[model samples]
Each structure stands twice: as C-alpha cells, then as structure tokens.
Target: MSGAGSVGNDVDIDIGALFASLRRNWRFILVGALALAALVLLFCLLSTPEYRAETRVLIETRESIFTRPNGETAADRPVLDQEGVKSQVEVLTSADLLKKVGAKLDLAATDEFGKPSLLSRGLIALGLKRDPSQIAGDENMLREMREHLQVYNVPDSRVIVVQFSSEDPALAAKASNAIADEYITLQRAAKLQSNDDATDWLEPEIADLSKRVKESEAKVANYRASSDLLVGQNDSTLATQQLSEISSELSRVRANRAASEAKAASIRRALETGAPLDTLPDVVSSGLMQRLRERQIQLNTDIADLSTSLLDGHPRIKALRSQLADLNQQVRGEGRKILKSFENEASVARLRETELTRELNGMKAQAARAGGKAVELRALEREAAAQRELLQTYLTRYREAASRTDHNYLPVDARVFSRADTPAEPYFPKTLPIVGATFVAGLLLLSIFVLLRELFSGRAMRPIDGVAQAPANEIQMPAADETAQPVPGRAIAEERAAAGTEYPARPPASAETIQQIYDSYTTIGDDVPENPHSVHAIASRLIETGISRGLVVSPEGDDGSAASVHLARELADRKLRSILIDMTGTGAISRTMLDGKTVAGITDLLASEKQFTDVIHSDHYSDAHVMPLGLADPERAMRAIDRLPIIFDALEAAYDFVIVECGPSNAESVKRLTSATTQIILSVVDPDDNAVALSALDLDENGFEDVIILTGAESSTPTPPSGDENPNPRPAL
Candidate 1:
C-alpha cells in the first residue's frame, strides 16, 4: 500500500515545485520578454513619423452672412443651425468635391511614378518595396489625402474643426484648407448646372406648346365653319317652334277629314233606310258610322222583342224583321259612304298640304337665310383659328425668349465662394501612436503565451511537507521445521533455548507432522526466499549486523536465485570456503552457481555412491572450498539434512567458515537444513512484503533475526529538516 501511495504521489507538482521551476528557468522568460520589447522598439524606430495640423470651419447660415434681404441685421437671426452644420460637413466629404480637388490640383501627375530614385532603390533593397502603381491616382492616394484632412463638429458650437496629420505640418494645414475650398466650388458648380438645365429644358417646351395651342384653335374654327353650325343662343328655340307648327297643321287636317266622312255617312244611311235625307240627324257632328251603329242596335232590339211574342207570319214580327234588315243595310251603306268621303277628305287634305307646303317653303327660305349667316360665321371661325395659330406661335417664341432672358441672370447661389490652396504635407505613418501601440500589442502577446503555458502544465507539490514521521520497527524471521532438523552441536542447542522449545532428535516424516508439534511457530514454507544466502558463512556475517536465533534455510535457495548467488560470491570474497547444499532435487545450483565444475554433489554424498571429498570442489578460496548442492530426489533432499553433522564435522576441521545454501525455508527439507546452521539472516526489500523474502520473516508468527532492509535505490527528494538552524542540513535517511 505504501508503494502504491508513493506511485500515486509521484507526478504531482505543487506551488513550491512550480516556483523552483521558474527560478531554474527564469532566463527563458526574461529572454522572451526582452526580445518582445526589443522587437517593439525596433519597429518604432523603423516606422515613419507623422505630424498633425488642425483648423476649424464654421458652417455659414443665412444669418452668418451679416447681410440679408430688406437690410436685416445679423443679430436678428439665430447664431447657429445644427442642420446646416451637418449638411455642410457632408458636403466636405462629397465625391463631387473630391473629384474637383483632384482635377484642380493636378493630382494625376503627382500620383504617377518614374524610374526609382537612389533613395527609393536603397529602400527597396532593405525589403521595403514601394510599388509605382500604388503611388498612382487610386483609392490609396485618395484615402491618404482624406486622412490628412479630418473634419469634426465642435461640441456645443456651430463651428467644426478640420484636423490633418502629415509628415509636413504646413502641408497638413494646406490640405485642410483645400478641402473647404473644393467643397464650396463644387456647391457653386452644382447650383449653376441645375439652373442651366432647367432653363434649357423649358425653352423648347414653351415653343412647342405655343404651336400646339394654335393648331387646336384652328381645327375648332374650321369644323364650325364647314358644318354651318349656328352657334347662337336662339337656334334651339327656332327648331322647337318649327316642329310645333307642323304638328298643329297635321292635327287640323285630320279633324276636318273626320268631319267630312261623318256627314257623308249620315246622308247615305238616310237614303238606304227609306228616310228622307232632310230627316237624317247631323251625322257630321256625331260621327257617321257611330250614328249608324246606334240605329242598327235599336232595330236589332225591336226584332228580337217582336220574335219572342209573334209567329213568323205575324205582321208586327214581319215589320220588326224588315226594320232590322233596313238597319243592317243602312250600316253597310254608311260604311261605303264613309270610305268615299275619306277619299274626298284625302283630296281636300292634299290641297291643305299644298298650302302648308308653300308656307313651309317660306319658313325654309328664312332658315336658309339664317344658315347663310352661320356659314359666314364659320368663315370668321376659320379666320379666328388662323389668328390663334399665329398667336400661339408668337406666344411660344415669346415664352422661349423670356426664359432665355431669365437664365442670363442666373441665381446668385451659383457664385464661387472659395478656392483651393496648395497642400504642404503628406499624411501617413503616425510615429508615437504606432510605437506605443506596438508596445501594447507585444505586451498582450507575451501575456497570452505565459497564460497558456501555465494553464496546460499539470503539476502539484507533495502533500506531507509539514507532517510527522513514523517510527521504524524491527523485522522477525520464521522458525525451523521437520525438514530442517538440528545438527549435533552447541549451535543447535542455542537455537532451541532461544526458541524455548525441546530439541527434536529426528525429523518429522511430513511437513504437517512438524507443524502440529510447533504450532506456535510459523515456519518458513518450501519456496525460494526473497533474499537468501547460498553460503552459511555469509549468513553468519549478516547475523552479526543484528542477531538471528532460529534460522531457516531452503534447498532451492542454493542456486537459480540471484540473492543466493550473490551471498555465495560475497562469502568466497570474504575468505570463506562455503559448501552450498542443494537439497531440492534439482542440480540447478551446481550448474548455474558453480558453472558445472563437479558432477557429484549432496545427492551423491548422501547416497554414499561417491565420497564427499570427490563431490566437493576444494580450495575455492585460499582458506575455504565449496560443496555445491547437486540434483536430489524430493524425498532424498528432504532427508539430506540428517547427515549435516557429518558434512559439517568434515568441513570444520579444514575451514573456519562453512556456509550452506538450503532449499526454500517453508519446505520440510529446509527445516532439516536450518536446524544444523548457526543462525539466520533475513534479507528484505524495504518496500516489498509479497515476495518470499518478507514472507519468511513472519513477524506476526514465528519471528525473525538480523533482518537487513534493502531499499530499492532512488534519488532522494531535497528537503530541509526542521530546527537546529543549520544552513547546510544533512541528507534525509
């Protein structure tokens, strides 16, 4: 967990760390800022300087003229008009005025470029290429010219200021004056043009309209004359009178004709009825056919009444019938007589018509006389039309002449009020402002770069800077077991006394059997120990570093393990001839550690198949030789430690140190081997416990001795200790 925590805390960079980084790399920041400042300064030096000149212009109102119509005084009018000021300001920047300025100043010639002057060539060589086309009359020059002349209204006043910036002060002033001059000239020209255009258009229009009026009048007169239209007031009354007279004559003729026919019918009826003509009523007054019808009705009534009471042969009935027949005959005769009377009446009507026709002819003659006057009037109308045409022509010409005369004295508004003056300066490259602005820009860029760099770097400092430290504790080693039975000597007795247990003369048959007897002790199991010694001599020296009581060794530790190999070499260099016993059934130790120098090892010695002297390699060092652990069967390796006293007695007489590398400490064979050794030396990495080295030192169980904590090497963090006031503090442990 400590190891995990250390890894988690590794990459954090706190404020202190950041400050340290800054302190260490301060040069980079200083260089960057200085370089920026230098660049800004250099740009300022290279940039062209510009100067400004300002002038004020007041918009002239009607009141400002100081003279007015009717001789009014200037004090009588308002001092300033805002609308007029705005209008005049707009005119100052108008395209028309600018174009006029362009023309009047011969700007076209100044805008073009010739072959490069020596100074221009030098400037070009310096990477400042000035194009001839850019200098030509275009938007750039116009813009530059405009920039030199700034026109603005003065606050709370009718007056406006015209400010300009240029390389030459006098030129700036002149350009400003020129803008005002050109604006006035443009105003005058525009007014004159407008007035002239109006006059020109009106001239031809007046002449043409006069001609059209004359032609219309002539057409009206000629129409009146040819149609003989009596346009007098009484003509309508006369026509009405003539119509009434003709109607009256026709009515009278019809009445007379009716009267005559009636008279003729009555006479004929009297004759047909056998009445005397003298006895007939005046049918002329009554209407001839009407009277006959009345008589017929009376006869018919008598016939009908008589037939109802009398037979056909009766005299009264016969008489009545005769009367009805006479009545019918009278009616027929009256009808024929009326028709004849109509013919005679028609002849009489023709005679009256002839007389009326004569009268009508006389009236027509009078009408013709009036119509002849109308014709004369038409001739007069034609003469009037010709005169109107002539009048219109003359009027049109007169109007044209009048308009031309008015144009000759064009309005005073067209008068030129001002003229342009020569400019004295060019306007561009404002020096102080450009340089100051560059400085500000450079500062901003530097700030942005710094901010971004700080944002992206993920760094934090350690959390335990002011925290208290924890105390260290000693590590313990595991106890011996059945496979690691004791050797016959005082060292074994000492191990037994230190552990407060009785010495077992013979090893247990199985690891479980030994575990049951020493239940209080957590013995090392059969696995390669983390930091095991290959030689007992090295183990004894490690024990001298502290104290180790009950020692456990494993057979697998003799070889194949880096720790075991290192221990064996260390022992040999310390002038000790160590015999490494491989009790694990594999001859890996002898092959790897000894480089296969001897074929016979512990297995051969234990089996008595080869003498111990023949298997052991003598004189590895001046004072010691080594008996390497060789290949063994599992059961045989387990039992190999039972003969440890014999091997040790042989080696003790010849050498001062006898180191044995045993199988894994947890194995039964290791217990047998450890019971023979002097003491145990437990090697542990400072920050590891899962490895076999720390497991063997079961500090919670069997305990340990001479535990040397070997920390994996690392560069120490630089931190000062508290108190003591020492400027140069000792390094942390």
Candidate 2:
C-alpha cells in the first residue's frame, strides 16, 4: 500500500526540480544566446546606414491685429484643429509641392533618384524592358521623392512633422528644409489667389449697391415733393408744427375770453346787489371813477358847511344838493359805460377765440393728410437707408481686399518652427537593442525547452505521499442527493475552505470559455444548474477587458436586479474595486445592500441634496459599495438627469468597476449613463424569459453589440416580503 501511494504521488510536478535541471543546462542556453547575438551584430554591420532629418511646422493663422480686416478680432481667426493639421500634412506631401522641392534640390540629376538599377539598364539595352526615355523625368523624380518623404501630424496638436531620409546627411537636412520652405510658399500663393478672387467679387457688388442707394434716395425725394411732406425742425412735418402753433393760440384766446366775461359779470352783480363799487378791483383801478368819486365827496362837504351857516330854505343848500345829485347821476352814467366797454371786450375775445378754434381744426385736417403721406415717405427713407448701409459695407470689404492684394500682405497659415539640421549618426540598425533582444529571446526559449524536457522526462516529478497521507480537514456542507456532482469552482472553494484557507481569486478565463458563457446564456435551458451561469463568470470577463464601468439592466423586474447585486458582490470578492448604483426605484438593492435602510443615493446627488461622499454607502454583507435610490422626488430628480454622465465619470475614476442596476430600463432611458467602453450586462433570472430576448435585441439595435446576459440563481441577498415590512411601504387607502 505504501509503495502504491508513493507511485501515485509521482505524477505531481516539483518546481524545485525544474529549476535545478535548468541550472545544469545554463552553459547550453548561454552558448545559443551568444551565437544569436553574434549573428545580429554582423547583420547590423553589413546594413547600409541612412541618415534622417526632420522639420516641424506649426499650422496656425498668423494674421496680426493691425493687418486683419475691420470688425475682425483674434476670436475670428480660424483655428487649426487636428483635421486641419492633417490637411496641411497632405499638402506638404503633395506631388506638386514635392516636385518644386525636388527641382530646387536638383534631385533628378542625383544618382539616388535619377539612376535606374543595373538589371533594368541591361534589360532596356536588350529591348526586354521599356526604354528609360519612355518614362518622364519629372514623374520618376516625384516617385522617388515621395518614397523618401515622410509627413505626419502630431497627436492632439496643430503641428505637422516633415521627415526626409538619404544616405548623404547634408542632403537629408537640405531636402527637409527645402520642403518646409516650398510648402509655406505654396500656402502664401494660395492666400494671394483667394484675396484676388475676393477683390474681383466685391468690385461688382459694391457698384451695384451704390446704384441701388442712389435710386432709393431719388425715390424718397420725389415722394416727399409729391405728398408735400416737407421735414420741419426737429424732424417733424411743417403741417404738424403749424397745427401745434395754432392750437396754442386758440387756447390763449379762449382763456382771455373767459377772463373778460368773468370780470363783466362781477361788476353787474355789484350793481344789482347794491354793494360798494369802490370795493371792486376793476372799478378802483379806473382813473375816471376815482376822479368822479373825489368830486362827489367835495360837494357833500360843501353842503354840510352851507347847512350850518344858512336857513333850511336857503338857495345855497338846495344848489349843493342838486350838484350832489348830478354828481351821482354822472357816476351812474360812467359805471354803465364801463360795463358796456367790458361787454365789448368780452365779445371781441369770444369772436377771436372762435376764429382761432376754426383755424386749429383746419390745420388738424391738413396735418392728418401729411401724416398719411409721411408713412409712404418713411418707407422710401428706410429703403434708402438700408441700401446706403449695404453700399458702405461692400465698399469697406472691397477696399480691404484690394489693399491686401496690392500690397502683397498675404501670410501663410503655417511656419517652420524647427528646421532640420545635419545628423552625425545614422538612423537605422540600432546596435545594442537588436543584439540584446536577440540574446534574451534565445536564452528564454532555450530555458523553457530545457524545463519542459525535464518535466516530461519525469526528472521534475515529486512524490506527494506525505501530504496526501495527512489527515483531511472536514468541511460542513448542506446535504444533497448522491447523484449531484459538485461545481468545479465551488468544489475548489469548498476544498480551500476545508483546509482553513480563504478561497483564492481567479484570473480571467480563456476567450473560448467566455464565448461559451455567452452562448450558454442564449441556449441553456431553464432546468440547467445555476453554477455554470453564475455571476462570477461575468466578473471574469469584466476583469479581462479592463472595463471600469458597466450599466446593468434588468428586463424581468426585481429578479434581474437581484442578479446585479450578486454580480457586484462577486466582483468585490475577486478583490476588484466595485460599486453598485441602484437606479431602480423598487428599493430592491437597498433591501439587500443596506438592510432596508433609506439613504441618500444618485437621485439625491442629482437633486443637489447630497454629495458623492454622502451617498456612497458600504454594503452590509460584502465589500462592494452601494448607492441606493433615495427619498428625493423622482420628477425633481429627473429634471437634473443631464448630470448623470458627470456622476458616472466621477464614480469610474474612484472605483475599478461601477455597476448601475436599472430595473426594466430600455436603451433610451439608460443612454446617458453609458459610454463607448461601458459594458452592458443584462441580469435575468430565467433563461427562457421573453423579456430577456426582446431586451437583448433592442440593446443590440441600439449599438450595444456586446450585451452580457447574466442568468443564474437569484441573488443570495434576500428579497423583501410582499407585506408591509418594506422600507418604502405602500400607503394604505
């Protein structure tokens, strides 16, 4: 039994024995490597050396502020983007530009470009090949120049690199600098041609615009004369100004008429009511009334003096009383005349007011007519102004274009920033790298062969009897049927567990196995075991592609969401930095990852109610992070949905793999969260689910060609019950 056990253990490989055999064969590996290196060194020595020189051109518009056209700024200068720089590269390598450079360098007469092969010359002499005279000299030289020229654009910049190679170092430098100079000259010539074209185009346009402006101005003047709409001061019509003046005069006349009438009525009331006339302002202001009142007062005083000196029937007293009565009669007559004069003044004022009012009405009618004609006049003026503006713009452009063409102010869009210099060393046949690489490769190959031979010959085999004879650690597992075979990965995990060690993380499987997993997703029956369709397989593929972000979709509702939870956990188990974002509003991920706790999540972040640090929560059962859909209003959250890409970018930068669980989401709904490299994983519980097929087809049509379908046992994270124990419990009626 002991001999059989030792023989059984002989099949095991011993890493120590393999290394020992390799050490014994060190001389063979060294000899082989030295021979390979020697051959490479000889080849380098025999190869002809070619020298290369380069010139760099910066493609940009070099127009200065003073030289640029009016109303043009630096912002208006054309920017040379990547494609623009590439276009400049094509221009540099063009046959026309290269021919100019070749002619300048006299390349066609040089031996390198002008001379044909000896075999070709021999054949031509024998009439077996086409005669050399049949081919054009320029075409032959152009072909040779193109073969020697190398032009390319620098990545993410507006610089182009021009390189030339030749056996003569001085010729290489001269050719490269010549190419740059000729290309710049070509650009300047093209600009000059464009300016000439612009000047020719603008000349006719400017003339036409000037003619239109003159015609429009003449039409405006003729219309103004016919309609009698002459412009007055302050840009108003003459009729309007006259009407305004008449209206002002009419107002003054009516105000004076009213004042005169009021004064006449006041005097009349005083006469009727027996009030004092002297108290009246109009009566007191009159000189005639004042003199009359003084005379009457003197007569009264004389009568009083005579009554004291003479008898009651005296003739002097009677005469004085008669004089006083006459004085009162005269005062009454003067008061009547003053009242009549006031009436006359009121009458004249009223007549004048009526005449002015009629004149104002007539002027209003004339002004209305002028306003109607002024509309047409204004239309003509606007047309004239528009034409004048257009003429001025054309004249400005024509002058600028003509000035540029006349003064030869054309500037090329590119300049040589770095000119080529003669190189002292050859560019090809790097000696050290070639020899060292050959020696390392030869040694590594010989060592691998020796190690393989030792293992195949059983010299590297070691007996495992000692380990196999040791007591096996017991593993506790659920009881199953006897016919049930263990899964390969799970059995390995169980064996590791039994030996009191953690299950090791596995690297990505082969491409064939990954393709098989994808095929099994479409073809595997519902009765198939879940281990083959486990989320671990998807995790391995994710690791293999180095995908940092994934959009998880669940077509079969919460069941698929559970699978995404498992995927996140499986990725975390593999020691990858993974996070699960729960976009599903059903709180399925929250129940599993957060144990039914309501926390701030992506919706909260979008709503600006929480930040990234506040929303990302640690998974309760695993190392994976969880971002659950929070209590923020869904409508409000969707208002800021445009910010989802920024959130995804931040998460991708922070973690290795970000898995977003979108329950029952379509391509359009999740389009904002995906990128060109984002992996799409469809988590479905049933293999035969019709929703899975439909969703897959929809995703494929939407440009997601590599949709990964995760169909396996439901997530071990427990789903919430149907009753009211849910965190987001439904409200009762």
Candidate 3:
C-alpha cells in the first residue's frame, strides 16, 4: 500500500519547483534580456530610412480619318489604340527622353561640397559613382537619373507611374515633376530641330548636286563628239577592206620568202660541201611537188618509148638522146629558172615586208592613241556617273524634306497626353514610418536574441506536487508531558486481575518490547484481547490484555529541549508517558515546558548541589517529567558528555521513558551523549538544518538503530478531514 501511494505521489507536480528552477538560473534570463535590448539599440542606430514619391501619366491614342478615293470619309474608326498607348508609355521612360530631361534639369552640377548633388552619398561611398567627365562622355547622366526613378504601367490599365526617391523630400518631388515636363518639351524641340535642320542642310546640297548632274551630262556629250566611233556600218567596211589588202600582201610575201629561202639554202648547201638538205617532208609530198614529179615521169616515159623504137646508133635515137639530154638540160634550166624566180620573189618579199612593217606600226600607233583617249573618256564618265548618283540621292532627300516641311503633319500618336503638375507634399525619409520601422526592427532583433539565449541555456527543470498529502510509512510521536491521558482504570484493573490468576507479574521487558507495545496500541484495531499465557483470565471469564509500553525517543542528543513545550502537548494527546531531559547545562527546555517554573536540572545534579529528583517537573503531561540542563556556566555545557555518565545512568533507571534533549550536535557534549542512546530522531525545519543533522550523523560513524526526521511543529487547527491524519503512523520515535 505504501509503495503504491509513493508511485502515485511521484506523478504529482510542485509549483515551487518551477520557482526554484528560475531562482537557480535567474542570471541567464536577465543577461539575455539586457543583451537583446543592447543589440536592438545598435541596429536602430545604424540603419537608414527611405521614402518614395510617384506621379501618374495617362496615355491616349486617337485614330485618324481616311478619305476614300471618291472623297468620302471613313467611318467606325477606333478611338484609342492599345499598342499606341503602350508604345508611348515605353517612350516616356526611354533613355533618349530621360537624357533630355537630365540636360534640362542640369543634373551634372555639384553641391557646395563638390559632391554630385543628384547622386546618392552612399553610392559615392561605395565607389559606384564615376567621374563627372566620364559620365558626360558616355551620356550616363540619364542612366544615373533613371536609377533614382522608376516607371511602371499600371496593370490592366493604360496609366503609367513615374516614381522617384531622394534623401531630400522636396528635391525628390521637384525632380519627378521636372522629368515629366522635360520629356514632353524635349520631344517637341527634337522634332522641330530635326525637321528644320533637314530642310536647311538639303537646299544647298540639292542645288550643287543638280549642277553636278548637268556637268556630268555635258561630259557625256563631249565624250561622244570627240570619239566619233561608229558602231558597225562604217568601221566594219573599212576594217574589212584593210584586212583583205593585208591578207593578199601577206600571202604574196610569204610565197616569195619561201622560194627565196629555198634558193639561198640550196646555194649555201652547195657552197658548204657535204651539208645535208633537210627539207620539210610535207613540202616534198605537197600537191604542187606531186604534179611536177608526175610531169617529169610522163616526159621520161615518152623518151623511153622513143628510145625503144630507135637504135642507139640511129640519128633518131641520137636525136632522142640528144632531146633527152636537152630535156635534162631543160629541167636543169627550169630548176635554175625556179631558183631565179625565188630570188626575185625574195627581193619583193623583203621590200613588201619593210613596207608592211611601216604600215602596221602606223596602225598600232593610231590604236594606242585611240585607247588613251578612251581611258580619259572613261574616267570622265565614271566621275559623271558618281556625280549623278550623288545628285540623285541629295535631290531625293531635299524633296522629302520639302515635302515634310510643306505638309507640316505630325507623326501619328506624337501629341502630349498628360502634363506634369506640382505635388502637394514632398517625398523622402518619412519621419513617422522611419521611427516606427526602427522600433519594429529593434524589437525583432531583441526577440531573436532572446530566442537564441533560450535555445543555448541549460538550467530548466521539472516540477513536483502533493508531498504534504503523501502517505507516511513511519510514525513519529512527541515525548509525553503532564497533559497526556493515563490508561483507563478498568483496562489496567482487568490486566492485573488476569495476571494474578495466571503467570505472576515480573520485571518489565526490554526497550525493544516497549517499542513493539507502543506500535500496537497506537495502531487502530479491535478492543484489547486476553493474554493467552494468563490461565485465570480464561477460568474467571475476564478478558485482560497485557499493558503496552512505548518509548518517546528524541533525536540522539536533542531530546526535546528547544521543542519541549510542543512535544509535551502532543504526547498528552497520545496518552503516552513522556519525559524530557535537558542534558546540556541549559534550563531553557525545562523552563519552557513548565511555563517558567524554576527547576533544578542536570547542572545541579551533577555537582551534587541539588538532588536529581528535585529538578523534575510534571505539569505539562500526565505521565511526563521535565528536567532542565540547569543554570551552569556556559563552559560546562561545552564540556564532553562522556564526563557526565552518571547523569545518563540515573535518568535511564528513574523513568519508564527518557527524552534526553541535548544541545546541538556540534557541541562536544552532544556527541558523547549520542553513544548512550538506543535510537535517534532528528528535528528539522530549515533544509540547511537537515544538512547539519546529516553531518552530525556522519561524524558518529557508529549507526544509530533508528533515525527519524521531524518537521518543526506549528500552531494550526487539527488536520482537515480530507488530509492524512497519520502521515508516518507506524510508531513514535
């Protein structure tokens, strides 16, 4: 039952435990809070604030009316084109427009500190800003301006917003409005300048190009007149005639040269003896050579026929031989004639060749001259062509410019849709929001710090409850005093009567039996039963129970000296014989229990100054006696209890129950007296006092038979009905 109660009690929680845990780790929580606050303050101090201003612009596009061929106006034209509105919105934020805005605003100027006024100081510190000259060269002023400005089309709408921010509120608002106005003005000025410049530049260019075109045409006419070269009729006839004449002359010269070369070669060959005449084979087999050979063969055949008919000695044969000889001679003569003809032809060829050479040279010289003239004319023609092309280009440009100027028509969707207006309030580091943001940021940092500290610390613990209501397994009754009730007369009388009839009453049992008897009487049970060892009780039919004895033991040396009054009252209610002995040389316990009654105590008894019995007081409990430590010198109380053995022996013999209330365990006197006690029960209230008690127990080294821990008594009503009446109800110590 006790074990189950303990298990149930173990699950209970104590609120005090949580308080105790916090108390133990107060430093952690406090330090965390302070550090968090400090970090919050630091962040709040370091951060900067930003604000923005925005202006909205509406884009509108109008459709133009187109006249039909018959001069009828087109109907059902769309008012605003979505694509045109989108394109305008895009153009408004374009770099070209923004550049003009920057120029109009004179954004390149610096402040008194020589720092660029339009650029952020933070950007400059971070080395993001370039030199002003470099910025100008790259036309980067617009880029820098755009960094501070933002343009966005409102979703599902044709409205656009131009937002800008600056450290200075007024400057931000001014710049925003200025950008819008300058963009519109720049568009107008750019269009006008472009058109005017186009017209101004094209007029002289077109006139000069026209003059160049006329000059080119005159050059072309002059080239035609100077050349006078006919295409086919005249030149072709003349060239054909010349070619025929040259061809005839060349053929004649070639034949003559061939014959002359052949004659000269033969003569040279004859002069130079043994020289081989290596004539061409084709020449030998030519038709002309074949005809000549055929004629010679026919003549020879006639001569041979004539020779066959005539005798060798006949005049006719002689004449034929002579004729044959003559023919050979004639052939030789003809050969010579041919050679002479070749020589004459050679002479003619030489002369003809010389004349033809002169003529050909003349023709070549004329051709060279013509070619040079053609080259010059071609150069002039190229120049004229280039001039004509340039003229055409310039004339076209000039015409376009004149046309545009005359028409004076703006491009579609070019007109202004919205104008900049002055803002009512400046935009910049907003005061309320900045301060509020700082506070919020600080709090956030503080919370983080606290959370981190909680995560890292390790001092939290669980709680306990219901200790006061938990059942007790051991009983602790105070020492008896004068107020204690005596056992009932009938109960005592019955016990005596049964004892007389049976086994005679003998000397009392040992302290162990006394302890047992105390346990039984205090335990709740049925009425007293008869002693089986007493025969007379059965014969007389009288139920008699043996009288129970109990000991009201105090702490080893504490007795009940300091707590004697309370102990006496508690003992009286329990109907126990309780005696309080102040073994120390102090009469405090005796005086307190007896209500200031003067009592001779241990001091007087030990010195033989007063009898031991004379110091006892019995008013506080029915069967209880109080003996003070006596009014001895403080030095005697400090003396060792081993020196006072007689006093302990006398008290043990005189009382059925002895309650020795000694001094604190630290006193040399108490340690010595602890050895004389059979059991020890320690009274304690303060937790630290328990430590002292444990220390004293350790010092003894010899373990006591019993050690009971007691809480200091407090004056209160009897235990409430629902509370445990006997927390440790086994027996009193």
Candidate 2 residue pairs that clash: none
Residue runs of model 3 more than 4 Å from their true location after superposition:
1-148, 151-196, 216-292, 298-327, 356-385, 396-733
CA shift of 307, model 3, Å: 11
Candidate 3 C-alpha error for residue 525, in Å: 99
Which tens-of-lDDT digit does each residue in 347-435 have in candidate 3? 87888888876776665565566666666777887988998888777777667666656776433323334444444444433445555
lDDT of 1 by residue, 438-473 (tens): 656665665556544653665423454433455455
RMSD of 3: 40.8
Give the distance in Å from residue 667's predicted Cα in candidate 3 to where it truly belongs. Answer: 97
Model 2, stretches more than 4 Å misplaced?
1-25, 115-140, 155-157, 247-357, 437-733
Model 2 agreement with the true structure over 308-327: per-residue lDDT tens digits = 88986898888888888898
Better of 1 and 3 by lDDT: 3
**At residue 657, what lDDT does model 1 achieve?**
47
Error of 3 at 636 (Å): 99
1 versus 2: better TM-score goes to = 2
Which candidate would rank higher by TM-score, 2 or 3?
2
Model 2 poorest 10 in a row by lDDT? 724-733
What is the lDDT, from 0 to 100, of the residue 339 in candidate 2? 79
